[model samples]
Target chain A: MKTDEKTRAPVARIPDADVPGTVERMRKGERRAIASVITELERLSAAAPALLRSLQPHLGHALVVGFTGPPGAGKSTLVNAIIAQLRQQGRTVGVIAVDPSSPVSGGAILGDRIRMTAALDDDGVFVRSLASRGYLGGLSPAAVRIIDALDGAGYDVVLLETVGTGQNEIDVAEVADIRVVIAAPGLGDDIQAMKSGLLEIADVIVVNKADRPGAEQTLQQLVGALSIRATMSDKVPVLKTSAINGEGVPKLIETLDQLGGKVRAEDAVSRRRRRARYLIARAASDIVANRIKAGSKGGLDTLADSVLSGTMSPHAAATRLLED
Target chain B: MKTDEKTRAPVARIPDADVPGTVERMRKGERRAIASVITELERLSAAAPALLRSLQPHLGHALVVGFTGPPGAGKSTLVNAIIAQLRQQGRTVGVIAVDPSSPVSGGAILGDRIRMTAALDDDGVFVRSLASRGYLGGLSPAAVRIIDALDGAGYDVVLLETVGTGQNEIDVAEVADIRVVIAAPGLGDDIQAMKSGLLEIADVIVVNKADRPGAEQTLQQLVGALSIRATMSDKVPVLKTSAINGEGVPKLIETLDQLGGKVRAEDAVSRRRRRARYLIARAASDIVANRIKAGSKGGLDTLADSVLSGTMSPHAAATRLLED
Candidate 1:
């Protein structure tokens, strides 16, 4: 137990690992080895290629399912049920719940702690909650890499529970094979699920807390909204589940199972390919930003000050920095 | 009128001001001459040294205020009021709204439309909606440049309205001078505001829809949450407002006025400098990533395919790319 705790702690280290050394360790077929490797990677203050090389093989195997919606929508409850059903089928599972981070201290309580409390002791269930390190989408550049870790660790199905669907949760749209948006009644916006871009991204919509009033109304509204915006290319399914009583969970799993079968049969890999390219581009961009910020000897700062003061224009400042 | 429409159309004839020759024209300070020049700058997929140079004088004169919270918090309404008040005070305003892009088309509908709806028809109110070009925060690299355009255009206040307080919305926290999170009654999860990092980033909290039930409770909770989590740096103020009725709006504006005064007094220039550094570094990274992606033929795609096929590891693939 002590050794396991020690091993697990290093997975969250930061500012370490350029893409290279990590790749080298991963190439050695050392699964648990990457744990300590991420520790060293954290020390580097940037992603190394060697590490990325090591991570590539592990990422492609698992079916990554992203679960997101507004808070109190019982997202974890639904996820818990889905995991249990998959476990019954003898499938290994990996769970990544993106927890909120305290901006001041950079500490997070990992909300899934209470939700997945029962699964803690199960060796078949490996759940990790990533704290949002002030990155957009509740995901830092580290998330894709962490997903790689879970995939390499041999989890057959990876369940990614996002922070929510309000604004930034859309980051999951970049990485998931399937995205399930959970919602309930009285979310204030009668058009809660429909308004904004939320209407467009959901592959599967689950109206949890079905026992409550307005569940049917919520479903009808979503169906109505989907009819208006949805392309015939895909017919989104809306399901209702009472996460508290575990009602309708089996059907939700069945819906997911059917979708999974279809995605694998069709050109889902191509879609994933496009998304992967975007992710790589984003990661590379993050690295460049960090490098530029670190390398500038107060040059960027001074220019920023000048621009803000109206003494220099933003474009002039940007041009100078880029050209330099 | 028809000719003007033809010119303003984003897809129509490229704005001559943004053309290659625009830079040469700009060095001469030909005011209306540069309008076409600025528009032409948007078409080029390369670095625009001329546009950057032209914007050198006005990058940071504006006080950037980000208005965010849950949907229906009357953010637009509040902004409209502020615009009116600022114009009364004889200050020009620039608005950037980060709206979610269409999932299918990735286009934004509210870009020019929302500003018009707000009755901000004055020559001084420059309003633009920035849709995501597949970026995480629904903001493009062009956004900062647009801010520059507005700044150089002589706007004293730049107001940025993000999609809302989800993960992506939080990214705005890093880019603005003042972040005002708008909340209202019946949100239910006070803890969510904290969990989402809204409470931490807010320099001011406006509980819009003050007439709604639970408004007082929500405000109280927000106050309590801030007091507990805040460092010794500053205390965030929570104000009540009805953007519809115009109640508390004057107070809100006064608060903004006071905050701006304080920022100007205490190292205002230095603060802009820090933000400028952050922006440049971020942009520099985007450039590097774009080059690497474009430079590598289908190299990245092939490796991603292998990883997906379970043939090679992610780390291995990333390693190969790094070596290249």
Candidate 2:
């Protein structure tokens, strides 16, 4: 389902007054343009839609990989190692680390950005930290748009790292081409993975900090748990890595490359279709919610008062709002 | 503003043909009717709207208390102890335990239900477990509706227990009139409460398992942390309770009663108004999302394919759908 060169040709000369120039600059790998576009998208500025439309033709070139696990799992260290490996292969990378719990000025965001110093100095790598502006999921609502911009800006791979603690965090699986679920020894009992609902969505399970005493036991437990589920066409591999000592990172990278290749070769169309559907649906919901909020105009407060005073039911009030 | 008796007169005889009979049965404390209505609401049945409209007059009578904390914080045990205390005071209680990760038939649900055997055996207690149904938060989308139904069904108190693992789970604060944030000794480092985003929303902080060695340190840490935040009119209390042996349970109950009383006596109308607004807003979002899903026939699929094949951007696709 790849677009033919003829179809791609039209995008090279997009005439949109708000976007064409910036898109051209971004496509030339202009870092400032890329950053500005991302900032606009993050702020949901009026020009974001036009910019995204202009950049559409150049998107879909980057492989988006998602890393999710419980906090304190050494995901940052592992991500740094992976970035180093990808850099060695001459691949440009972009990273979005999502913190759901942090406020806008929270130190956690600064800490995460500082910890990625290994990639900060490299021109081939870019890193950003996104805090939820009261959004439920760890990732910002504009994450998909930013990822698209990164893809269009000639990044070869985009890494998404989120704290896997709630059902909303599981949404990362829908956005990424390859989903890695990281676990650490002694985090909790074996049932922790199952309880967090991570085992089901994991494309690859990495037992990080494998030098710890319980690492082998945890690995076996995860493997055993994975086997009990009905096997899928692609068997999910449980790998061990010690991010502290950099052991087994190369193997993990190789596995990721092979898996990414297989996915691109075999199921890219279907996967992209699914991701597109999810993104559109989510965007539609956000639009509708915003519209409702904008239109309420003290009407919601009156209706709420009526419900509280027992003159109208919450359902009836909601129905009335929807009707309006 | 509290409605006068004259204003409440008409509600005594809601003439809605679809819901009068069931509402009557539920108001009479018929357990079967209450259970059936809740099940219908959970399933989002067609009759739910009518039922809720009829039940509206009887709603706003229950005190909704929310208990949330990290996993393994002994929240269930504390809730169980609270239920016993409330029951001893001759108050009927309704319990909703939310598990975000559980599948429909997951053992966690069963395990939670089993743990509440003490309450299940009593006629004064009605217990229900809600799985996320892939909802982002542990709470079911129908949770507010179910709570209203319970309130209408003559329950004096409604208890909502959820795992505080992500930002979405914080939605419990909207639904509950009084929120209890639980922590336990040796759960993790002192920063655990802050990381979970529990400290900001806690109306009451309970240090469960207070018999542990580090309980004093944890309690002092929590107190110190709480001191840093600007104080409100009513200082949020930090209580210590060892739910294992029932120590501190009575005092906890006393504190709850006093707080609940204060809330009801001082700001019941405002609180109910706020809750109603939240419910209506959430309901509107759900309704709009559902309408979008229902309205998009093969149109969405086509748009998604276009986005995937790079013929259109996701933002453009979403805009098209919203316009339609």
Clashes of each: 63, 0
- Distance (Å) between predicted and true CA of B265, model 2? 5.8
Q: Cα lDDT for residue A222, model 2?
A: 71
In angstroms, give how far residue B244 of model 1 lies from its true place.
4.3
* TM-score leader: 2
lDDT of each: 0.61, 0.68
Clashing residue pairs found in predicted model 2: none
For residue B4, model 1's alpha carbon misses the true position, in angstroms, by 18
Residue range B22-52, candidate 1, lDDT tens digits: 5444434454434543453433222234455
Alpha-carbon error at B152 in model 1, in Å? 5.2
Fnat across every predicted model, in order: 0.27, 0.31
Q: For model 2, how does the per-residue alpha-carbon lDDT over A1-324 read when each residue is reduced to its tens digit? A: 222254332232223474778878888877777888787666555455577667767766788899976555677778888888789889999988665545523545445454655454677887776664333433454677678778878899999876435433556766788999888887552234233456656788999989998989888767755656656424888899998788888898888888888777754445556676776666665565566555655887798766544455555777898677
Top-lDDT candidate index: 2
Candidate 2 residue lDDT tens string, B1-324: 222254332232223463678778888888787888887666545455567667766766788898876555677778888888788889999988766545523545446454655455587888876765333433454676678778889899999877435433566765788888887877542134133346667788999989898888888866765666656314888889998788898898888878888777745456656666766666565565566556655887898766544456655787788676
> For candidate 1, lDDT tens digit of each residue in A147-173?
666666567788887653333366676
Give lDDT for model 2: 0.68
